[model samples]
Target: MKTNFQKNKIVEHPKESLAPKSGDKKDYTQSEFEEFIIKSGAVGSYMIFRSENEEDEMGISEL
Candidate 1:
């Protein structure tokens, strides 16, 4: 008899606050975020922001 194996994918949804809501220190610096990516072994990451004109823009940084 033969047996087959399959790998399972795990997804996590962690709640994070990017900005301080009520004078609380909950935000992280750009360098800190970059360090996190490196430590997490992520291949790449990107960010999206809205400009003053309400236009969506995408930014990518090389790690």
Candidate 2:
């Protein structure tokens, strides 16, 4: 079986805060981000990994 997938352009990074900023508040916690994703109609697997440099990373794949 052959599988084909089209690349998607990520206009916004997941780690970026989706809520409007007020004063110096511009970061979203993990739970808040997850909530935003769910509300945005995202349905698939979400993965969190660590890069070779030990920096944390995450991504969401829509199935």
Models 1 onward score TM values of 0.27, 0.25
Write one digit per residue (lDDT tens) for candidate 1, span 1-63: 234586558777678746647887746798998898889976535445567655334443542
Q: Rate the local accuracy (lDDT) of all candidates.
A: 0.64, 0.64
Q: Lowest summed lDDT over 10 consecutive residues: which window, candidate 2?
A: 54-63
What is candidate 2's CA lDDT for residue 2?
Answer: 37
Error of 1 at 6 (Å): 16
Worst 10 residues of 1 by lDDT: 54-63
Candidate 2 lDDT, 1-63, residue by residue in tens: 235697768686677556566685646688998898889966556545667655334443552
Candidate 2 Cα lDDT to native: 0.64
